[model samples]
Every structure is written in structure tokens, then in C-alpha cells.
Target: MPGPPILTSPPKASPGDRVAVLSPSFAAPGFAPAVHEQAMARLADLTGLTPVEYPTTRRLGASARDRAADLNSAFADPEMRAVLATIGGEDQITVVPHLDPTLILSDPKPFLGYSDNTNLLCWLWTHGVAGFYGGSTQVHLGPGPHVDEVHARSLRAALLTGERLEVTDPDESEDVGRDWLDPRALHEFGDREATEPWEWAGPPKSVTGRTWGGCIDVLQWILTAGRFPADPSVLSGGILLLETSEELIPATEFGWIVRSLGERGLLEAVDAVVVARPPASSLEVRPTKQACAAHRQEQRDVAIETIGRYNPDAVVVVGVPFGHTRPQWILPYGGSMTVDGVSRRIWADYA
Candidate 1:
């Protein structure tokens, strides 16, 4: 595939800039006020910017049309420099169809989100605009003591500046979640362990292409919706970045998603792949750390096997760190990504 050109948009955010935060999918904040408040406060404290909220940002069970309207308003608001989502929800794909394509394309601004927000990121790219994943105030911004250093740095670059984004190896990584009930748990319920160097396992050489993909579960929705997300011609040689959400989809299901991508001819069309650490278990499953890690590794192994079978020529990098992680970095969707398998890092260049 041809290299993706840098997309066009205004410069990054400055201090005191206005940005809109909305819940386009599920309103996660409704159930957890502490996380929601902390995330909002952090945005102001760290960025020196005011976050404007819309009607449904904290309202769960919001209609898809209502969420879509909030998005359009945020994009159309002359004063707002950018738009952000609180966090990703399972049903963002439902909002995609209701959105005004013309309005978004004509008045595009910087957007921040990941996970289910992948629907929006992919949509923006489909409409010829760039989107940023890895900047959810709730996830990156926390009710805990502070934001993760790696995540904060990345959020800064992605929101206010465009620089050489470096991928960092976590000295310690945690696959655990914070407890919403016990304040003590909120202080520190998660576990962290030593992290190995990122593994890059794609082709024999380096290749750069546009970046795409999101939480494997959400991507599945887009694929099943049966709408045209991109021009097939431009997809040739694009780089695919993918990760599973904290919901901890089964290993067989993860493999099935990759196999489906191959079925849809998406795997062969991309030059390389960047996979993130999957979310092992949510409160729903409440699996132990050992079980969570084991499940996640199994899913990763399944994805690796599928990619090998379907797109053997494609370059693949395992564990580059994004999606559902505390210190998530915003990745450029449908932008340039250089996969250096030897170096085990995927360098994403955004417009």
C-alpha cells in the first residue's frame, strides 16, 4: 500500500483552549462518579484547558441519535478546538451510521478516544480526517493519585503538539483494574510486574503504511454492519493496529476475529500489524491476575497464529502498548506507521 499522507487540521491545543467531551457510546461515567470526576479534574490540572461536557456525557442509556448530535455539535462549535470521548463503549458502531458525514468531513477537528471509540476513529478516517486514540480522561485520567507518566506524555503530544512519538517499554505492567467500591482499593488494587521488551515479528524488512484497527470486539461490529468503511484501493499496504478491550474476549473469539479479517481480505491488504495488550477481565469476570494474564497470552497467541496463516508476508509486532492500559498512548488512525520488526517498535507518524 502507498504511504498515508499527513491529514490536514488546525494546530494543536494551547493553554485555556476549549475542548468538548461527550459519551458517544455507553455512558460509563454514570455508574462511577469518582472516575469521571478525577478524569475531568486531571484534564484541567495537567492541560490547563477547560473541558466542556454535553448532555449525555454522564447519562447512561443515551440514545444513539442523541450521542450523534452531541458529536456534530462539538465538531461544528466554532469555539471548540477539538472533541474527546470520555471512554469507549460497545455500541459506537451504532452511532456511526447516524452521523452526518458531510459535517464531520468539512469541519474536522482533533478527536481523542480508543477501544469502542475505534468506530469513530475509523469513521473519521473513512471520511478523510485523522483521529487520535489513547486519550480518554477516565482511562488515562484516573480517580487514583495521578495519571501514568507514559500516558500523560503521550496525551500532551497528541493534543497540543506533534512530535516524534516514542513507544516506551513498561518497566512494570499491570493487567489489573481498580475497585470502584473500596476507596482503599481505589488507592491501589492493581498489580504490576516486570515487562519484557516489545516483540516485533512481521516481515524480514521495515515497512510503513497507514495505521488502522481498534478493540477487536468493536472492529467486529463494524465488519458485521456491512458498510463501506474505506476505499479498497487506498487500503493496500496499510498498517493494522489492533487490541482487545478489558472485557477479555476468549482466545478462540480473538482468533476468529483475525480470521474474519482475512476472510474480508483486510489482512492481506495491510503491510504490518501492531497488537496491544488485551484487557484480560473486567469486574464482570473478576478473574484472578494469574488467570487474566494466562487468558490474555492465549488470546495473543491465537491472534499471532491467525495472522501467520492468513497474512504470512505481513510484518507483525506483539505488545506495543495501547488500548485498555493505564499509560496508553494515542495512536494515529489511518496515518503513517513504520514497523521496524528488528527494533520491535512501531513508529506512527500522524498529520
Candidate 2:
């Protein structure tokens, strides 16, 4: 994959940089503290660095302002090189309204997370601060019993190192969820599924643009709250990313959302779209793999039509694994992305 060309901020990490990990979202540690401990240990092992925590990281029911404050302190601290969100939570939209953009924009660094973390990623872009969209100590750091190589490599590149990351489908994947309370399961890798190759649906072309967009569900929230991005021209040269969450929103509904964004003048704003594999929601969706597969494709088709309806020129690539799923890869929001549709390749460059 070719590295993307956009540069919105200076790289902020070296091999031994001190990175702060905070929970700008919910802290499940109260409900699953062991999982949190395991995740932190795993992150330290993978990065060859120490992990610092905030008072609210594992504190449930923390106010939005409190989370926002922790976020500000993490960014403003001179000793920090990068900031990592533990895991995503619902209602991060709340964090946005109270966010102090000045804290982050002035001293930008690598920021990583997915799911609800979308709120912050979009916020960073709007305020002229670049951030990354993949990698989390809790998810990628704790994939199954062992961290999948794909997630680890991508996380490392996004955080400590800014290099052209290798994008490859995992040979096998697991969708089973274990009780975070099960201490024994913590030592084991989760179940596995054979993975098909990442596919691009149309004729080849390549575009270099800044990375934007996040979990589609969260994008919906931002849109509904009038927090959706301002204009397409601002995103005119950037690669726009869209991924589904575990909620498994239907394809038809997905189309409606994109069409809505188009109505808001969003579709024509991008040069390309990187759509993710729709998350399989129920046991039913998982049992019927073929059906689940079809659901994902249909959703992509709907997205393509929705965007094409508004801007026929927008390029769409399906299946960049990074959101609400296993073997997640890191994405750069407000950073550069290179989509080579001709070669059916995509790469987000942070350095």
C-alpha cells in the first residue's frame, strides 16, 4: 500500500516517547477491571513503554466535562508524546459539546481509538488538528487471548512509529465474545474464522487525500445533532472513511444516512470512501455466514449509490477492517490516505 500524502500535524512519537492512555469514554473497569489491567499490561508489552492512567479511566458515570478535562490534560502535558483512548463508549457526543479545542489543536499528536471515539476524531479535524483513527490499548491491545499480529503492527505504526503500514486480511478471525470476567479466558485467543481477501468493487484509480469519517453509527449521531462536518470542499481532497459498528444497522438504513449526508452537501465533498465490513450483530447473522456476507455487500452497494447519487465522481472502496471488529487496522483521521483503486490498495500515512 502507498502511504498517503497529506500532512496536518508534526509526528509526535519516538521509540521511547511517554504516551498517556486515558478513558475519554466509559471505563468498563468497574464492571470488568481485570480486562482493564490485562489491556494495560498488554499495551506496555507491545510498545516498550509505560502506561499512565487518569482518575476517570475506570471510573464509571464520569461527567462529559470530566472526560473532556482528562483529555485536555493529557494533550497539554509536556511529558506526553501521544494520547490513546482506552475503549469507546456511548454518548461521546456529550464530550464534543464541552471539548476545549484549544488544548488539543495547539500541541497535536497521535490520538487513537474507534467506535464512540469518532466524536473526537471529527472534532480534531474540524479544529484543524490531525489524529489517527485506529488502535486502542483495550481492543487491539487485547484481541482474544493474544493480540493479533495485524492489530499490533497497525497500532505500532500508528503510535510509536509512522511508517507505511501493511494492510492484509487476517488468515483467520474470531467473533466469539468471552465474559471479561472469565479470568481463564483472558489467557486464551478468542475463536477464529477464516478470512476472505479484502476486495475493491470497481475499476482501478488512486487518490491521495486527508483521512476523515469514523464509525457510521456515530456519524449518524453527529449528523442528527448538527455536528456533522461543514462542507465537501473542505474535504475535497481527503479520503473519507466509513465503517459499521457491532449494532449491524441495515443496509437500506445505511443508504438513507449517506443520502442524508449528501443532502447536507457531504458526499460531493470527498474524493474517495473507504467502507468497512459491516459488523455481524446477532448469532443468526453469524450462523449464516453467507447471509452475513450478503448483508455487508448490500450495505456497500447502497453506500456507493448514495454517494454516487450526489457525486458520481467519488471513489468507494469496501472492507478496510478497523471498526467494531477483530483484526482491526489503524486509520489516520486528519492525516493522509492513499487509495489505489487500480491496484486495489489503501494506506494511511501518519509520518
Candidate 3:
């Protein structure tokens, strides 16, 4: 199969523009109406854009075809200048195949989402359209005391202004979050742990390329569905942006996933890899602080080791501010990014 084109960043949405907020995956809004409303309010407050919902935006258990139709309508509507997912979900892969590429191509707008939304982002990338990789309405905008400055700035750049921005590591980060069902979820943000400085390995050099990759498990699903490029060479010189989700796969399993990528020749093809800090604890797991720390360390070790096995020359940076964590950084999926191992700096071209 032919490689994906050098995707173009779609037209940015201006203030006062109507941005379609849809639940392409899970109907998060259905379960957390307060959170969803707060998110819409936050989006308007932060970006000066109007949040318009689609037919299936808050309809719980909507079929894949219905979700795809909502997405199609969002993309096709001339009034909808951008599209944002309410939140990520596990079965977005089912919804992707139902989408009509013609609709997206005819009126490509800034599509913002991450995690399970990776499926749609990759789909758009395959069709030569770039999207922002981290902007869930409920997760980032709602439920917190305030929208994170880093997240707000990145979202602003992606939506209102097409400007290049530096991706910085947050001083503190959190994996655990408040329960959406709890009344406190409207304004309370859970505890955060002190973050470590990003660790860099491999060749002490800088490389710039289009960004690719997303939540590792979601990417694995996409790969399993054969949605990614058939030829790994297409990703040559690209920066691999990967992170684990709340599920928090074991270190051995994570290694196996990375190894599988290597086997498919993806690791050797990319110039650099940026692994977001894995969420070490979750409501379900609820590990102790020490255990969380240990889990994170093990994840980092396995990632570095696995990448070294396949491509020792490739630059690998760990502890990026993205993924299923608080204080997330919104990155341009398929957009350009610079990874400087020697200087230990990262810059993304949001434009």
C-alpha cells in the first residue's frame, strides 16, 4: 500500500465559530451531564467558540454507524468550523470504518481528540489531514478546578491560531482523577505527584519530522485492524508520540507491544520516540504511592530497553506531558515536531 501523504493542518477555527462537540466514541456526556456542560462552558470561555452538539453527542450506547453519521455531519456542516470529541472510548475502532472520507476531505477542519480518538486521528492522517492529539472536552476542560494553562495554550494555538509552540514538561502531574459521578467532579481535581525531568537516550542529536502515534493500546488496535500504513517506511524520520492509557498494561506487555512494533519495522523507521508518562495508578487499581512510582520506573525501563533492541540510534525521550494524565499537552497529529536529544528540548509546529 502507498504511504500516507504529508498531511496538511486543516484551517484553524476562529472565535465565534461553531465547533462541533460530538461523542464519536463513548457517550461521556450522557453519563456526566454536569461534566459535559462544564466542558462546553469551558471551551467557550477559553476559545470564544460556540460548542454545538450533534444527534449522537450525548446519546448513550449509540451504534457505530450512528456515531459515524454524527461525525460525518460535523465535518460536512459549513457552520461547524472544528470538531472535538467529548472523550475517548475503547471501541472507536468500530466507528472509524463507518466514516465517509469524502465528507472530511471536502471540508477538513481542526479535529481534536486523543486516546481512543487516535483511531480517527490516524484515519484523518491517512487521508492527509492533521489533527490535535489531546483535547477531550470532559477530561481536560471539565472536572478540574480550572483548565490547565499548558492545555489551554496548546488548544488555543491549535484552534484559534496556527502557531508553533514548545511542549514543556509539567512541574507536577496526576494519573488519578475524581469520579465523574461524584458532585465534586464538577470542580475538584485529585492529587498530583511531583514529576521527574524528561529522560533522553540514544544518539545525542536533534531531528524534526511529522508527529505520529498515540495511546499505545489504541494504536495496537488500529494496527491489528490493519488501518496503519502497510509500508513502515512511510514513517521514516517521523517522531513517534506514544503513551499508555488508564488500563496501565504491565511492563512485560508494554515491552511486547513495543517489540511487535519493532518486528513490523516501525521502531527503526522513526527518528525519535516521545513516551508520555504512563498512568501508574487508577481508581480500579489504586496502588500505593510507592507502587505507582515503581510501576512507572518499570515502564520507562522496558520502553528504553525495547527501543534500544530495535533502534539504538533513535532518540528516545520519556515523561512527556500527554496521554491519560492531568496537565496534558495537545500535540498535532501528523504535524511537524522537533526532538533535540542533545539539548533536551521539544518543539511542535501547531501550524
Q: Give the TM-score of each candidate.
A: 0.92, 0.91, 0.98
Candidate 2 per-residue C-alpha lDDT over 184-255 given as tens digits, one digit per residue, 9 for 90 to 100:
657765555676566564436788888778988898888778774454566766677888776788898888
* Alpha carbon lDDT of each predicted model: 0.76, 0.75, 0.91
Query: Tens digits of per-residue lDDT for model 3 on 1-351?
Result: 444366878888888999999998999999989999999999999999999999899999999999999999889999999999989989999998889999888988999999999999999999989998999998999987999999999999999998888899879998877999999888788888899878889999999999889999988999999998789988988999989999989989999999999999999999999999889988888899899888988889999999999999899999999978889999989999999998899998888
lDDT of 2 at 169: 66
The most accurate candidate by lDDT is: 3
**Candidate 3 clashing pairs, residues 3+ apart or interchain:** none
Model 1's TM-score against the true structure: 0.92
Return the TM-score for candidate 3, rounded to 2 decimals: 0.98
lDDT of 3: 0.91
In model 2, where do residues sit more than 4 Å from their true spots? 1-7, 282-287
Worst 10 residues of 3 by lDDT: 1-10
Candidate with more favorable, higher lDDT: 1 or 2 = 1
**Looking at candidate 1, what is the lDDT of residue 180?**
56
Tens digits of per-residue lDDT, candidate 1, 88-129, equal 877787788788877766667789898888888877876678
Clashing pairs in 1: 1-236, 1-237, 202-315, 202-316, 203-315
**TM-score-based ranking, best first?**
3, 1, 2
RMSD of each: 2.4, 3.5, 1.1
